[model samples]
Target: MYFGKKNSEEPEIIMEDTIVYACGSADCNGWMRKDFASENYDCPMCGSQLVEEVRELPKIENEYNAFK
Candidate 1:
């Protein structure tokens, strides 16, 4: 790695508590935000049942998930 000047203008993010759906299977790591979830849907990665949970996530200013 080459040495370079470190920029100090990186934006700071605010953490917020949000509800999300997580896979019920212990071996699966699939999860999604609440608003992006569909009713009665299972984990998209492992097809396991989903459970509701709360997580601290990076706050969004104006961007939103376009798939919803």
Candidate 2:
């Protein structure tokens, strides 16, 4: 007996250590990667100040990844 075809599974989820600029507001839900954030250092969603935080987040999939 032999296997006809191997099942192709999705690529494993990749996690990465990334720095993010999160909203300082306690009641706001806003966060973004530091690299993609605005230079003004403000939350794009709630007009609040942003703070730096180190977090382990899922790898983001984007066109830019092709260059890496």
Candidate 3:
């Protein structure tokens, strides 16, 4: 028995945080966390409005500017 070897049967851990804002536009794929969104609270893409909703997704870092 080798103590240095770890078991490979352990299950992987997955964390699904509930915090995300999706663009209201049907053709936009922009989304970000509530804490990272702009103060205006608008969609990062398409310059559309955003609605707060609970969704399971990974965290991301992005900056949205409507003046583009």
Could you tell me the TM-score of candidate 2?
0.71
| Residues 11-57, model 1: lDDT tens digits | 88889999899999999999998877878679999899999999999
Clashes of 3: 0
Q: Go through the candidates in order and give the clash count of each.
A: 0, 0, 0
Candidates ranked by lDDT: 1, 2, 3
State the lDDT of candidate 2 residue by residue for 22-53, as single tens digits.
89999997999976765789888888999999
Between prediction 1 and prediction 2, which has the larger lDDT? Answer: 1
Model 3: how far residue 17 lies from native, Å: 3.6
Task: Give the best candidate by lDDT.
Answer: 1
Q: Whose lDDT is higher: candidate 2's or candidate 3's?
A: 2
Model 2: lDDT of residue 68: 54
Q: Which stretches of candidate 2 lie over 4 Å from their true place?
A: 1-8, 61-68
lDDT of each: 0.87, 0.85, 0.72
| Worst 10-residue lDDT window, candidate 2 | 59-68
Q: What is the lDDT of residue 27 in candidate 1?
A: 100
C-alpha RMSD by candidate, in order: 3.3, 5.5, 8.4
